[model samples]
Target: MTTFADLNLHERLTRALGELEITTPTPVQASAIPEALAGHDLRVVARTGSGKTAAFMLPMLHQLLQHSRPRTDTRALILLPTRELAQQTLKQVEALGRYTFIKAELVTGGEDFKVQAAKMRKNPEILIGTPGRLIEHLEAGNLRLQDLEMLVLDESDRMLDMGFSDDVLRLAAECRAERQTLLFSATSGGNAMEKMVASTLREPKSLMLDSVRDLNESVVQQVITADDVKHKERLVQWLLANETYDKAVVFTNTREQADRMGGVLVASNLKVFVLHGEKDQKDRKLAMDRLKAGAVKVLVATDVAARGIHVDGLDLVINFDMPRSGDEYVHRIGRTGRVGGAGTAISLIAAHEWNLMAGIQRYLRQNFEYRLIEALKGNFLGPKNLKSNGKAAGSKKKKMKKKEDAKKGKKPARKKPVAKKNSRTNKPAVPDTNSGFATVKKRKNPGSID
Candidate 1:
């Protein structure tokens, strides 16, 4: 319920936020900005849409404005894990800090390094970049951090999950060790991620806001079984068949899957876009621009590309594939059902994937309330040609029916039970990796992601 004005943000930054009609600070911003303003190193755990960016951004911008450092040298650095998110964060900094001389240069992958270098020569007060390119610039002597005072890792967990931990570690080492490092991630649990945070950050002032990591009760979860990609594609087409949402994102595990699903959705006559690492940064930005303009209604992306994609009022998120782990699932579905709007997360599971799906369900400790969606089911590979006599088919069908009846005989067949989740790290489904099944679950938060 606190307003941005109550946070004691600078008048200029507050005006800029006001121009965007952002009046109140999200929990992350409200809780974190003051601590950051006081110059404490931080390891913050908050959800994707919790406005943590502003938590750090407002304070970092204040530092630039307060210090009024020369434009020929950088004063602060923000190392993000992805180009899109770095770009997104950089834009916010630039927009909010426009009234001041605090320039923010986007140092990321896929763009011309020469252009980034030229911007660097201008020595902006803040540098926002993905680890690799920033490191590239650093190695080429295009960047220096001798006077750097602030460093932020937005989505730090993903930096580790995607194998960028070494890059980030290296960059952090290069910066002044005395500088404040603000680490923001969705998970700071007992997992490997939490360890990374502990190992990197100092006795930082940490605010453990797990609201976003919980099952945003606002984002409904409806699980479905799809035999294959075709049916899942059908499910998406059917879901969008009516086009109720202004925008939605379908998540796949691989870039190929994202590209294929995007094409299929477009062919099904939906306005769509695909975003992933394989595409150049320009393409990714184009896709995002289109989505923001509502030129594209469906965005298909992999987990890497989807992180930190901030779109307001995104009504739905589809897991074209269930995440390999619960933390990933929590972050992926978080794209929607944000900021108090109603949202839905639909995960399509294959029968063989039941092992994984079951692990996920057991993690949530809730058998998903599955709707058969029979009308939308695809003829998965046109149904495998039967290689049996009619009598054989009849016998198998009869036998299966009897087994189902027997299963039903155990008790009145009941609906999947829903558990109140505390957090992703609270409970886990026993995993068998040799069988390729392991899952962790978080209790459903009736409110939001932590």
Candidate 2:
């Protein structure tokens, strides 16, 4: 029953939230906003679609509004992993801070560098961007963060996974030494995350809103066994044809696969858009715009879209290829079932991908609902044998033989060494001190001459 007003947010921010119909603060927003308003560093671990963007943005905006500064240098910097996410955050900032006079600018790749530099000259009070392009701006002497009052690293884990650790760290180092830092991620990013937290935050308040295992409870996770790529393609086509969803996303492991799948879906007469790292920026924006406008019903993409794209009514996520890690799986399914909405996630598991799928399930500590499409069923049902941990059982013959030998108190038999042969003479070779080989020396010559 906690409202945005109860969190002591600025009147302008509360009014903006009211206009947006976001009256109640989500769990993350409720827990983080107060502490953030109190001027404490924060390291937040919340599920995706948990309103984390607003959680940090509201507090930063509230503070910025309460304290006015004459200088035009950027007071806040929000770094995201992808351009899409950066753009999304910019929209959120604009929506939430509409009533206030504070201005914000977005700096990311795939745009004119000179234009962005020109924008920097105007000195927007807030800056949002990806780390790579932002670092470039800093090096080119167009961007400065030494006077930044707040730094927010949204999707910090994904940034690390994309190998932005060095860039992020360098950016953090460039910021004001006493700036308040806020880090947000959906999954606990393990040791690397810990290291980054240590390096960036100071006496931070840790808010673990939910664990990875408990993410996306409203999403029904299921798997359909497939024989191969062709089988998966058929299954994907059938799902799109029959599934009840306003918008759906199909995730593949590689850009090549995303392109190929996009083609297949389009050929099946389904409205589809392909999004991957290789797509041009304009194409990416067009795909997203089309999806939001309902011009495209399906988006075939790589992990690039996992955390970047957000669409309402996106209630179905089809994993054409199983994600390589548990964190990636969480982000992919998170594309749907947002903000307590209901969604479905179906993964196509081929023979080669069964173990990887099983590993993800085990990592999440949850069993997926097994589903079968009777009309399009393929040869693969599942692994015949499974271990207690849900992994495919390995052959146990060798272990059984060892046990039998132990019971009989017998030492294992050793194979006799085979003699080395001289390749040229086709005769057994003898070992000597040098080079571990000595040929029969002149025996035929001795028999012929002496």
Candidate 3:
């Protein structure tokens, strides 16, 4: 029965929320807002679309309003892993601060650096950007955080995955030592993540709103086995034709795959847009805009480009290629089933990729239902053998090696390379007379061209 009123949000922010019809706080918002508003550093582990964005923003905005200073540098900073996320978060910030004089600006990559620098020079009250781009600005003396009051690392786990951990740590160190830090991630565990949290947050109040297993409870997760990439494409075509959906996002692992799948889907006469790291900023924005407007029914994207995509009426997510990790799987499917809406996530798994899927299932500690298409029943049914614990059986060769090594009471030494036997006799073979050396000796004797 708690509401935004109970959170003691700034009057202007409360009015803004009321105008937007955001009266009640989500579980995450309710749990973290009070602590965050109290100036305590926090680490929030919540599912995507669980209102994590507002949970951090509302409190940060509330705190920023108290001191209300117009300066040349940012008082608060929010670092996301991708440019798209930064842009999206900026939109939310603008909407929430509509009534307040607080100004927030984005400084992500893919846009003109000089232009962003120009904006930064104006000294907005808040700055949101990806780590690498922010570092670029920092090195160029365009952005500074020495007097920053608050720092929020949205999608912190993704930053590590994208290899921006060092840059993030550096940014945090450059910020004011007394600033409040908030780190939010869909994942909360991992050595690297743990190290970053320990260094960045000082005794943070950790909030675990949902576990990985329950992240997609609202989405029906299913698997469609495919023979290969081509087979998967056909299955995609079939699903789009037969399944019910408002909009669909097809996820691939690489930019090339995203482009290729987009091409395939386009050739089939389906309105599709391609999005990935290699795409130009304008094109990326265009693709998203088209998809959001329902001008395009499908969006093929790599994980990098899809981070910031949250389209209303998007009820289906298809994994063209199984993600490499459990965390990735959670994120890919998370594109749907957002904000308590019902959706479906389908993954295309080939025969060779069965073990990879099994590992993800074991990692998430949840099993996916196997669904078959009557017309396109692929050769891959499922993993042939499974262990007693329901996991895919280990490799036979690996199991044998382990058993043998255990019996020997020591590990076996690596086998040395065997020397190859010479097929020819030990004596050198006679040289060919036509090898251009037949008359070379006579000519060379006199050192003349005879």
- Model 3, 175-264: lDDT tens digits are 999999999988876899899998899988889887766675779999998998989999999999999999999999988888899989
Q: Which stretches of candidate 1 lie over 4 Å from their true place?
A: 189-195, 211-213, 365-367, 377-450
Best by lDDT: 2
**In model 2, which regions exceed 4 Å deviation?**
396-450
Task: Estimate TM-scores for all models.
Answer: 0.80, 0.88, 0.86
Candidate 2 residues 338-385, lDDT tens each? 999999999999988888998998888899999999999888899889
Q: Candidate 3's error at 258, in angstroms?
A: 1.3
The superposed Cα distance between candidate 1 and the true structure at residue 293, in angstroms, equals: 1.0
Evaluate residue 326 in candidate 2 and report its C-alpha lDDT on the 0 to 100 scale: 89
**Considering only N, C-alpha and C atoms within 3 Å, which residue pairs clash in candidate 2?**
none
Instruction: Give candidate 3 regions above 4 Å deviation.
Output: 389-395, 398-450
Q: Number of the top candidate by TM-score?
A: 2
Clashes of 3: 1
Ranking the candidates on TM-score from highest down gives: 2, 3, 1
lDDT of 2 at 256: 96
